[model samples]
Target: MCGRFALTATLEVLAQMFDVPERPNLAPRWNIAPTQQTCVVTQDPSGRHLASMRWGFEGPNGAPLINARSETAAVKPSFRAALAERRCLVPADSFYEWQHLDEKRKQPWRIGMKGGTPFAFAGLWENATDKAGQPLQRFTILTCAANEYLAPLHERMPVIVAPEDYARWLAPGPAAGDLLRSFPDEPMARYRVSDRVNSVKHDDAGCFERLAATALL
Candidate 1:
């Protein structure tokens, strides 16, 4: 599951890519953890629009659901309506996953498409009320079984929507359900990165630094 990811693209670039007219007020973030405000694009009759939304679902169990298994999300009570009516595009340049090195240890790695291209993850969103009676909009990333190249790092990976299929994914239907499959291993790449990404407090570009160039703490 995508517990942490990065979105470092500029507002202008995201707007053009997603066909959004009004851009949200957001900066380049290199280490985005769950529950934090992150950028999401949703489609309406008026067309696609970019907005900032808090990551994860505010559930009745008092726990935030950050990632949903794409296989079962269509039928899951918490995600069914969102999947059918409130689908969103979670824009990110890359995402972080942990590689199990041994029984007790793991290494952090960064995964992205070749040439480090920007992409969007298939996601679901809904409106909810916060603890203090405040209105809130939240979203959750969709995940599926990992491809051959990513199985070593983790058994699952977020479902990334391609640029060409963005419109179909935003439209609610069985066709959108077909887009939840794993992204091919050919266009994707993974690399060892500094463990600085393990913390929510760090949000700078340094968090994406190659671990081989630096040292992991």
Candidate 2:
């Protein structure tokens, strides 16, 4: 599951890359945890727009829903509605995954495009009312079975939406489901990272630093 990730690009860069209008006040996030507000790209009658939304869906039990399995999302009560009407694109520089080494430890790895270019994760959003009657907007990333490159780290990874399919995905229709497949692993890269990323409190450039090869053993 993609419970943690990073988005260090400036708002200006993101706006240019995603073709959305500039959002000057948007801040760079080195470590994005669940429930934090972040930018997302969506389409409407006017055109594409960049907006901020909380990272997770608030479940009936008050827990955060950060990820939705692509295979079952269309029929899952919590995600079916959003799947059909509120699809979105979640921009990120990279995402973190842990490789289970033993009961006492796990190694973290940073995964991104081969050249470290920015990309978007297929996502879904929803609008709801908080307990106090205030409006709340939130999103969840979709996950599919891992590609060959990522299989060693985990059995699953986030569904990455390609640039060519962005329009079709953001378009309103059931046909967009075809874009939820795993991205090609040949264009992806991964490396061991310092365990500093394991704790949500350590949100900085250090989180992405490569760990010594021996550290993984």
Candidate 3:
């Protein structure tokens, strides 16, 4: 699942990339973690827009972090309603995944679009409110079995959306099943990076620098 990812592109770039108006005060995040406020693009009864959504699915005080499994999201209670009515496009420059190769040598990999174009992740969001009657929103990324290039590192990966399918995925109505497909393997590229990314505090461009395994950490 896309538990952690990067959104280093500018708002204008994202606006053009997603074809939506930028949300004022949208900051660029180098190491976005779950439960944090992150940007998402969606459509509603009014029109398409960009908005910030809390990463982890919000429920009770200790709601689980069960990011919807793309393979079964359409039927799951936590995501069914949102899947049908509140789909979104989660744009990311790249995502990190770790592979446990040996007892002490777990390697981290950064995956991005082949030519560095940003990609969209299929997501579901819900409108929830707190006891104080304040409005709150939460969302989760959908994941599916990993592609050949990623299977060796992790068994699953986020469902990356294709450019042509963006509108259909965010379009109002029954389009979940069709938009839930996995990204084509050809357009994806992967490589190893410094393990500094292993720490959430190490949020910088250096964290994304490619490095030899011997020099990592």
In terms of TM-score, the best-performing candidate is: 1
1-217 per-residue lDDT for model 3 (tens digits) = 6768998888888888887865568766777887778888988677778888888776556774537898777787778888888889888999999899899998888888877778889888888765598898888898888888788888899988888888889888886586676677787888888788888887788877886754322
C-alpha lDDT values of all predictions? 0.89, 0.87, 0.81
Instruction: Go through the candidates in order and give the C-alpha RMSD of each one to the true structure.
Output: 2.5, 2.1, 2.8
TM-scores for all candidates: the values are 0.95, 0.94, 0.90
Candidate 1 has a TM-score of: 0.95
Off by over 4 Å in 3: 59-66, 130-133, 213-217
Cα lDDT of model 2 by residue, 35-80, tens digit: 9888899888888889889998888799999999999999999999
Model 1 regions more than 4 Å off: 173-175, 213-217
TM-score: the better of candidates 2 and 3: 2
Q: How should the candidates be ordered by lDDT, best one leading?
A: 1, 2, 3
What's the true lDDT of residue 92 in model 3? 93
Write one digit per residue (lDDT tens) for candidate 1, span 83-185.
8889999999999999888999789998898887899999999998778999989999999999898988899999999899998988856537788999988
Best by lDDT: 1
The better candidate by TM-score, 1 or 3, is: 1
lDDT of 2 at 52: 84
lDDT of 1: 0.89
Evaluation by lDDT, superior candidate among 1 and 2:
1
